[model samples]
Target chain A: MTVDSRSEKTRPDRAAATRDRILDAAERLFAERGVLAVSNRQIGEAAGQGNNSVVGYHFGGRSELVLAILRRHAVAVEQLRTDLLTRVHPGSALHDWVGCLVRPLPAHLAELGDQSWHARFLAQASNEPTLRAVIRADAKASPSLRRAQEGMFRLLPAVPAEVRAERGEMSRLVVVHMCAEYERALQNGVAPPSRTWETAAARLVDAVVGLWLAPVTPAVLGPDAALRCRR
Target chain B: MTVDSRSEKTRPDRAAATRDRILDAAERLFAERGVLAVSNRQIGEAAGQGNNSVVGYHFGGRSELVLAILRRHAVAVEQLRTDLLTRVHPGSALHDWVGCLVRPLPAHLAELGDQSWHARFLAQASNEPTLRAVIRADAKASPSLRRAQEGMFRLLPAVPAEVRAERGEMSRLVVVHMCAEYERALQNGVAPPSRTWETAAARLVDAVVGLWLAPVTPAVLGPDAALRCRR
Candidate 1:
């Protein structure tokens, strides 16, 4: 009765807080165990919810739950990219824009400090067809990401659409899996090849920039390739 | 008495055949579902074994089962890599040596024709930390892979060890994930980015070669990287 008289706006903030707690617990468990292995009941318990079904109630299912986690990070990651965009000049080198693409992730993870699992969680999701779609769709919504991509592409040679798409996929694989491996390595007391997250990001930036700058070789189109996309 | 003699000699062959059937079913199911989602009983039934426990009886558990699947493919892929090495002279270009590393995979998949699950199975395994170790250990055992690594390394710039290791990981992620995507795409009637298997392999080779050739950025080694190796 007293709550009914209070501001309804405060309720939304409480709901948001509950949502954050569920996502946090879900990401950590999913990262430590396999994604499919951890159940929503476990997530609810970890989130300190009394009801075991709270994760499902709040997020619907695993896919939505996963998306919520991706989205929670996407906003912050996009913000980092947006902040970095302010430093970019019109004629910056390809590597500079590339840095804009790669740096935001590690920088954000560093901000998360020791308890980071987003990168590992993401890497695990990348291998699953459905989960990977959620990530791709979320990434496609980033205005700053699209800007960095266009800026980088403008500096490179006009690659065939197929090659362009292929490289883009490669870029994703490298970033997610490398970070996953590095994060896992640090957690296991096995030293990561690159010392700091900053240096790891640096190495990743250099390799990715190189990937973009590499020349494309004309493939001898077999019947299938020719049928799919004739030059 | 005659039946006893025949059963003893043929028992080994029958067990071998059952192992092959189990591997085939396990790979197919694992590729279609996920590594953790499928059960040993389902695998046994799929393999046509009447005994529900035959999968566990034959292969021990999921890790061993996954390893058996990997080992089955490793020999043929390694053989192809070995065959390719004859053409790689000491002065071969970095791209040529890179071919030795990348081509064997798609080439082997093409050999399997329409029904191949190795790539997808590998992609799924890559998500699970334990399963991935089995794949990595199997790859490590191949003499040709070692030779290819050494050969590729010789043609490239002397990158810092951490950077070199980092890029090597990047190379693996791009190869496995892209091939997995391509395989799944082909299976589902979704046109792959590069149409044919050969063309897809060609694009991958070109990109990885570029990655290896990318200039190494000097790392600002934090204490961990510095301790691992000094410049």
Candidate 2:
């Protein structure tokens, strides 16, 4: 009787552990050092793997490695959103949906405790237009995210298509960079006004909701069209 | 006569022309490639200088080069803000103050036209936590900016101090990134709904004003103070 002789070195659990180690190392390196500066070999060494090509073998290229890192956090963040979404009723106010959108990220980071690199990783990646696509793709998987976005748009006033698009960009930019700043402040022992994650999220939610619902000037909307837009 | 060798090379016109050329090349390269990724040699070559050390000799290092580029635009944008300030009254509405904050940026970009790299350059530098200090320093030199920020803060609602600081970060992030995205969209020939810079500025001003004035959630504002904080 021939037993399956696959090596223990290639065991499923071992491979999974290896992937996680590489991801953890890569994230730290990418966060502290700029993403473009740190390399696959450095990541392998950081992960304690003697093989230089382990990173490439597991994650392919820098972009895919980046995507993998994003996927790791995104899963947890999405789960948070899913859990948050269950608490949000269908007829909940815009803030409820906005909360679902905003809270999960900070909550997840807070749970990660100190020395968390996910926020900085996100900040660095999102700043680069090309790299931001990976994040967007990962985010698209979350049903809760899609629903929250839909909820916001459904409640949105008749903004010019351009204005809506631009504000959407602004909202995302705020979320991405603000968290990075908060994380930096925490690491540097600089106490910001919103001391806790809860308060920070609250501040963000208020500003973002206001940003979405802010009145467009009559001149830009055109007085007649602006009146039509109001209702 | 041994009278002033290299005098032609040291001419003010030659130096000014060289500085402008280097700035142009650095801005384009930094915008297309990241500020960190591009080397001084590459910038010097791009500027048509034969000596590799020309960039370093002319502008010190990457940080100084970046600062010089920022100073170039800050002067123009500050002038624009100062000019706009002359029209703003002591009791101008929040949107008016926000306008002073928003308009100078897009208006300057619009004038720089298709090949403008200033917005993207700002976005890239501002995203890097350390690099942002240079921008803050340049911004401090603008009396109009200080006045506009103070005006907005004075008009602000009963926000928690921490919330105020967090939102301030959000506003700067949004401004830096939104302009980069807008510039990209324009470059890619993506005709957004807001066709003109004028309309885009109007939209940005409205949203930013709303963001500043958005109500803080009572829960986060704490129970004892929620009532007092409420409008």
Which one wins on TM-score?
Answer: 1
- The per-candidate TM-score of the B chain, in the order shown, comes to 0.89, 0.88
Model 1 RMSD in Å is: 4.3
Docking class of 2: acceptable
Q: Tens digits of per-residue lDDT for model 1 on A1-231? A: 366645587888888899999999999888766577678888989999999778988999788989988888887888888977887777998877988888888777767766689888988777678888888888898899999998899899999887887788888888888888777777777865437877778788888888888888787675565332211
DockQ of every model listed? 0.45, 0.45
Provide interface RMSD per model, one decimal.
6.1, 7.7
Worst 10 residues of 2 chain B by lDDT: B222-231
Please, what are the lDDT tens digits per residue for candidate 1 over residues B1-231? 256887889999999999999999999988876688688988998999999889888889789999889888887888888887888888988877898899888878777866788888888787778887887888888899999999999999898777787788788888887887888887788965547877887788888988988887777665565232211
For model 1 chain A, the run of ten residues with the poorest summed lDDT: A222-231
What's the TM-score of every candidate structure? 0.90, 0.88
Residue lDDT tens for model 2, A19-78: 999999999887765677677899999999999999999989888999989878877888
Give the Cα error of residue A10 in candidate 2, in Å.
Answer: 5.1
